[model samples]
Target: MIADLFPHAQPGAGLIGGVMIGLAAAIMLLGLGRIAGVSGLAARATGIAGSGAPHGIAIAFILGLPLGACIVASVTDWKPATYSAPLMLVAAGLIVGFGTRLGSGCTSGHGVCGLSRLSWRSVVATGLFMASGFATVAVMRIAGAL
Candidate 1:
């Protein structure tokens, strides 16, 4: 039904991805008592930040991201997108990293964990993130940059 409504969309993929993400988040929280925020994990892994989960666990989790994706892609026959602009991609990643630090947490931490726990800060941060994203897309679209 969703496929019929949106011919180019892969509805099942999103449902599956969301379920996997939720399951991973649940496991991280329940088993490790840690918030599944990639930025925080990266920071911890790189010794840029401290507290919460151990550095080793953070490093393992960071490494597991691509490994897990590879496993999923292998099992599902899914292909990830290839970015044409490597430099732009790297710049974007750095900007996002800085934003996450300024915001106190990334989407995974704030949107999933913090919001789930009804944190006001997460609520505001997530709202700003979404709004900023929307605005950026709109500006890019208007400038024919996308």
Candidate 2:
């Protein structure tokens, strides 16, 4: 119905998702007094690192990601994207993990939560990551790999 009502409204889904993320971040901040950084939470959950929040909370938060995705998949007519190769997927995951560690946060941490609070570190990190992403895409396109 929505797709039919607005044939070109592709941004609607993204906008809604962004708003939901912001709300979740805000709740984490205001209610729990913690930054909703997924990388940090995951690290804490796995005993790789510790944040100010308890490990149990972090574990629950980490678990909620897939649970939420599953719920959304059940209710919505959405499908996950497929990659060309399993090796490529593993490589991408490794790169992303390295990047999150290097940057000290992921996109959700810096782009959504950090930027909202006007953190200079996050601003610089987000800008650098965004530029790096664009450059990566450009290079991939030139190499006919994307």
Candidate 1 Cα misplacement greater than 4 A, ranges: none
- Which tens-of-lDDT digit does each residue in 1-146 have in candidate 2? 86888888777778999899899888888989999999888888998874456998899989999998999999999888886698988998999887897688989899899898899999999999899999988999999997
Clash count, candidate 1:
0
Summed backbone clashes in each candidate are: 0, 0
lDDT of 1 by residue, 28-92 (tens): 99999889998899888999886757988899999999999888889886877877488878988
Candidate-wise lDDT, in order: 0.88, 0.88
User: Which number leads on TM-score?
Assistant: 1
Kindly report which residue stretches of model 2 are placed more than 4 angstroms away from their true locations once superposed.
1-9, 50-52
